[model samples]
Target chain A: MAEFSLIETIRERCAVARDDVRLGIGDDGAVLAVPIGHELVVSTDTLVAGVHFPLQTAPFDIGWKALAVNLSDLAAMGANPAWATLALTLPSADAPWVEKFADGFAALAREHQLALVGGDTTRGPLSITITVFGFVPAGAAVTRAGAKAGDWICVTGTLGDAAAGLACVLACEDGADELIGRLNRPAPRIAAGLLLREVASAAIDISDGLLADLGHICARSGVGAEVCVDDLPMSEAFGEYADAPTRQRLQLAGGDDYELCFSVQPDRAPALLWDLAQSGCAATRIGQIVVGREIMLTDDSGAQIEMPLRGWEHFA
Target chain B: MAEFSLIETIRERCAVARDDVRLGIGDDGAVLAVPIGHELVVSTDTLVAGVHFPLQTAPFDIGWKALAVNLSDLAAMGANPAWATLALTLPSADAPWVEKFADGFAALAREHQLALVGGDTTRGPLSITITVFGFVPAGAAVTRAGAKAGDWICVTGTLGDAAAGLACVLACEDGADELIGRLNRPAPRIAAGLLLREVASAAIDISDGLLADLGHICARSGVGAEVCVDDLPMSEAFGEYADAPTRQRLQLAGGDDYELCFSVQPDRAPALLWDLAQSGCAATRIGQIVVGREIMLTDDSGAQIEMPLRGWEHFA
Candidate 1:
């Protein structure tokens, strides 16, 4: 098993036909034709064996999650994913593991119509770095600095499921496969992100917990947010927990939910809601932008609620 | 040191103002405004501590070489270096090590006027993955599939220096500091690559030895090459290695030179050589493309030389 042959295996496995990819793998670099009048969007993410996922996680899950996280970034920008390059490091050249990894990666790639442009494979401790490229209409990208005071804040899909899934995987909780699935393959809200481009003032994907990710929009847009605790969407899997505290912790502060968190102008909230509903994206109105420079969480009675937990912080 | 602060340190340290960079080093991803009528070229490479370099190599050299290898890919395609995103993995976040790594990376980046884009850092075994984005004129990129039978073959800078440097480093050969430098910090023949776009029938960078990389061009272009061993470029660092076998081994089969290998029509050779000379890139006419279906190497008196060494291969 030579390095060149391994790359050929990956190329054969991940092959997808896309006109935009003028050149794919097997070149010094990938040549891409960015369509006229379009702006390119790119992002990279690295996932470690034990730090980002459990060391025992399957190769398929690892490959899927690596691409998923990077796609989440493109989704945040309201960009259509076009291509990806993977820089994979492995402890050894295990044929079955590599084949399964490519299968998982290719399955999701086909689903999103993402072409594998190029990549590198090396011998090292197991880790995967995926750099995804996408395109959006010029000046149409929804960045983090556009939310204004009085904008309505919303989130797509449920929060806390992936966090609870992580807990389940780590504790070996019985019959919590649903939660574990969420952890292994949290879907990026790509459609929802594109829909929001027409109405939302700011957008970001929830990688860190809801509070932390929303706070990013606030900090960047120079506006504060007021989120209602009861409005936080927790999946049914979280109901299995005995106490509300665990659910709240996962919902507010646990990370790895690839859902879209966005803000819309007050005047456009109706249109945003209608469009999302029409597109079958389960979006929930959770909060509003305020003039103050702090993100405040409150109960239904208008009383301020204390922060339930600390956000996930790398290298803290 | 939280991840955010660490990113800020990298952002500040690696900051180089470039007009093409609309935004850099923060947010969900970096934004760039590609010039009109240009295509985007991208490449990714990962360097592991033990697999790609000596485990005890200095942090500065590691950072410089990591970006250097990726730049070589862009050079092969005649693409100008524009922006880069790094996905760095480390076992721990040591501040001193991080700073030195940033310093080394930034120095090379600034030299090429490449901006630091978005990146992700994780705790894991030490490895660095860099994805570089460059731009070339629409439909004007030098590709590996364009060489014809009459094209003259050439290579830039001296070959064998990097490989000789590797040997010295491994054997602790004295007074070979220059060779070690050549191994650790290869200058990508970027200017030469750009100049060859108008004249070269095909171009590639010498990373995995001359024969392997040229084999790429020949394989893609459906051509063969014939080389004169006496005409191969060898650096003065290998003067002590008087044996023809070792010289040929280091000159023809050693990897990591980061020099541009190109093929131009015999009629255009004069112009190509003049252009390279004006750009301060030392290029030599090593051989010519032939009609036969093999890359043949012969001595000055016409006897064929056996391929004495195999190129570096991962997972071999």
Candidate 2:
């Protein structure tokens, strides 16, 4: 098969209907009609073989994670995704492998009603780049720069599960595979993110460990953060893997958890928490923003805790 | 160095201010305000090392050609270039090499007044994937499906220069370095494309040789075409090549031209030529669209020309 045929195969299986998609998947370029009173949110992410995922990972999981990461970016901005373009590179053309990959991608795309609009397929080292385009009402998108000194910090769902999942892959651990599921097929908190846009003062999705990702919000918003270490959200699966030190390390410095971490004013914290609960979203308040530049941690005793702030470094 | 710092380095050097770019190269993903009454145009292209270019080519040229290819796609749609996101993968963190790459990218971006909105950097085999967004007036965009049987086929700029340039590199032909420039640095017909949108009924940018690219237009338009061999525009430098047979092969099957091939009504041909002349763009009428499905070729003597239709096939 030629490059053109491979692209057609992926496109046919991935097509989803949307009225706003003026053109999709076959042309020099795609034409999209942006609705009035909305601004487009676009972000691109690339996932490379071995570097971004385990070499033993299934092809379906790879395709799922590739689009999941870019959608995570859109979710962080409270943008409703509408369309996406993919640039796929492969070492060789494998028909069955590509069909499963397309199936994985289409499954997630259908959930969010995102249409595959344009793409390019080429022969090279295996890698996937996806650019997702979404829209948020004008002046309504949440940004990392909106956090204030007196805001309360909270996180949705649980953390440290994905990183713990990575550990299972590294050690070839079997039996309990929930963490591995979290690592390979992360559920992007799109609903929680869209809800937080109205009540939260600032927002971000955690990808590179809690500390490193939170530090970004502080650096951009010109504020400090104080996290109550004891208040860290942990799943039962993560808790069973290790003792205090290991759990703490995983929660604080482990990465690849695509959960939303956001902030709200103290006065509205009650209302936000109530609304999130009503929406069936489990959220926990774990920290507060301060006027200083420090990102400090504290134990139940109210004393400072010291630890390394490490995340996944692509070029370390 | 880490991915974040490398992104920051490229961001600092490639920044070009535009009012529409609400955020550029920082935060989670860049945000933009699209102009009202316009439709967004998007396209993506990926270039892999040792697959798209020579292994020994300069880093600067690679970056330039990477952005140039996607820009050509947008040009084919007759859209005004706006924002672009880059996904760059590199095997190692080489600071000076990256800087030069960014310099080459920024130079072309500044020329078109395009803003570098968002991107991702990663550690992997070298590849660059660029997704460019542009805008065209609603309902004014020219598509490949608009050609009629009577439309005259036209092309902008000379053919076969870039292919001959590649041959020079393969043979280490030092005396003819101009073709090498054509191979390494292709000039996309942005202005001519924008002009042709008002005059031409169907348009496509020549990337994978004349026959292949034009075949795309014909396939989409449900029509056929015939090229008068003697009418093909050739650069003076290309005339110094081997003999007629070699020249004919290079003209028909050679790829990487990066020019514009389009169809206009026969009645409007003189007007288009007049406009192109005023704009200092060299274009020629090569043939006419037909009612059948074959892409045929004939010489000045009115004899049928027979040659292989082979071009750059990625999977072949």
Candidate 3:
């Protein structure tokens, strides 16, 4: 098949009815209306085969994760998903693979009502680059530089599940479908993010582990953090599969959770959590922002705990 | 260096002061205020190392061409450039190469006052994906679906130069600096596009040869076209380096020209040409849109001319 034919297939499968999109897939550039009083939030992410995921990962999962990761960035910014463009480089025009990939992408896009506006497909090694655009009310975006020293640090959803999931996949373990699912199709916390924007002072998505990502908050907000190790949330599957040390390590340092780690003032924490729960999202308070510019982990008795692993860096 | 530090390096280098940019770099996403009464125009393009360009192409040229091509899409839409996000996949973190690449990208960005908002760096074979966002007045953006059968076909600048440049490079021919530069750094027709927005019936940027790009307009506008082969523009360098057959082949089916091919009504063509010339962009009337859905090329005497080469199609 030619590139245009593949693009036509993707367009047919990923089409969504959106009023704000003036022009969608078949244009040199997509024209979109930014509703009055809204600011645009943009983020780009690239996932390469073997480097970002296992070479054997299903095409559907690859498509899901590619869009999911970019959506996660929008979620971290407290923006509502609107549209996205995909730049896919493939070894060849594998029709079956493209079909499955489009199916995976379309499924997630439908859930959020996000339209695929425009994209480019080229011949090369297998890789997917997705750039997501979202919107927030003007001057209403929650960035990573607004945390105060006395703010309470909170996170949406469980931590370390994706890490545990990766471990399971690597070890060829059995009966770990839940963990594997977490790894393959981690959900973006868009709802939680929208709610958090009303109360959270600082926010970031955990793609490079809790410590590393929170460290970004620290550096950006000029504040430190103290995480209570016992307060870290873990899934039932993770609890059963990981030993104490492994759990601690993965919970603290594991990447690809796609959970929002944010800071809220102590006064607003209860109300925010209640609102999140009402919105069908469970959130947990795990730490507090402190004066020092370092990330510290503490146990129940408040003793500092050593980090087990460093965060994943693309090039180190 | 780690990814974040490298990002910091890029942020420091590509940073441009813009009032509309609420937050850029160091965040989960970039936030920008879209101007009121305007709509957003978005486009994406990806360039792989060997597939899109010769492997030995300079990083500077790679970066320049990547952004240039995306900007071309915005140009085709008659949108003014504003912001762009880059997703760069590199085999290794060669700081010098990155520095040069950023320099090239920054040079063009500075010319148009386009901001580098956010980007991703990953480990993979060399590839660059750029998503550019521009703005046009509501309902004023030119699209490919608006051409009428009586419109006159026009193209900005010259053709065949880039293809001839590629041929020179592939043959290791010396002293073809002009041709090679055309291949490495094709200028996007931003100014022409902005002007054509008022006069052109439909528009597209010529990247995949004029015939193919014009074919897109035909497919979208539901009209056909006839190109006068003798009227096709050729640069001095292209004329010097190519024989009659080579020139005809390259000019008729060359890729990477990054020029605007648009359609305008006959009554508006003269004024539009004068306006374009005043704006320092030379445009040529190459043909006319016709009633049918086929692209035909003819000599000056109106005799049908056969095309020498096919347009480049990915994954064909």
Reported per model, the fraction of native interface contacts reproduced equals 0.81, 0.81, 0.98
The regions of model 1 sitting more than 4 angstroms off are none
lDDT of 3 by residue, B83-197 (tens): 9999999898889888888888887888889999999999999999999999999999999998899899999999999999999999999999999998999888899999988
**Candidate 2 CAPRI-style tier:** high
Each prediction's TM-score against the native? 0.97, 0.98, 0.99
Better candidate number, 1 or 2, judged by TM-score? 2
Candidate 1 structure quality by residue, lDDT tens digits, B1-316 = 6677777878888998888666566667666677888888999999998778888778888889999999999999999999999988877778778888888899999999999888998887889999999999988889998999988999998888888888888887778888889899888878888998767899999998988888889999999998888888777767664487787888888998899999999899998899889889979988889885689998888788777556778898
Residue B272, model 3: Cα distance from true site in angstroms: 0.6
Error of 2 at A23 (Å): 1.4
The DockQ-based CAPRI class assigned to model 1 is medium
Better of 1 and 3 by DockQ: 3
lDDT of 2: 0.87
| Highest-DockQ candidate | 3
Rank order (by DockQ, best first): 3, 2, 1
User: How many residue pairs clash in all the candidates, one count each?
Assistant: 0, 0, 0
RMSD (CA, Å), candidate 1 to true, equals 1.6
Leading candidate by TM-score? 3
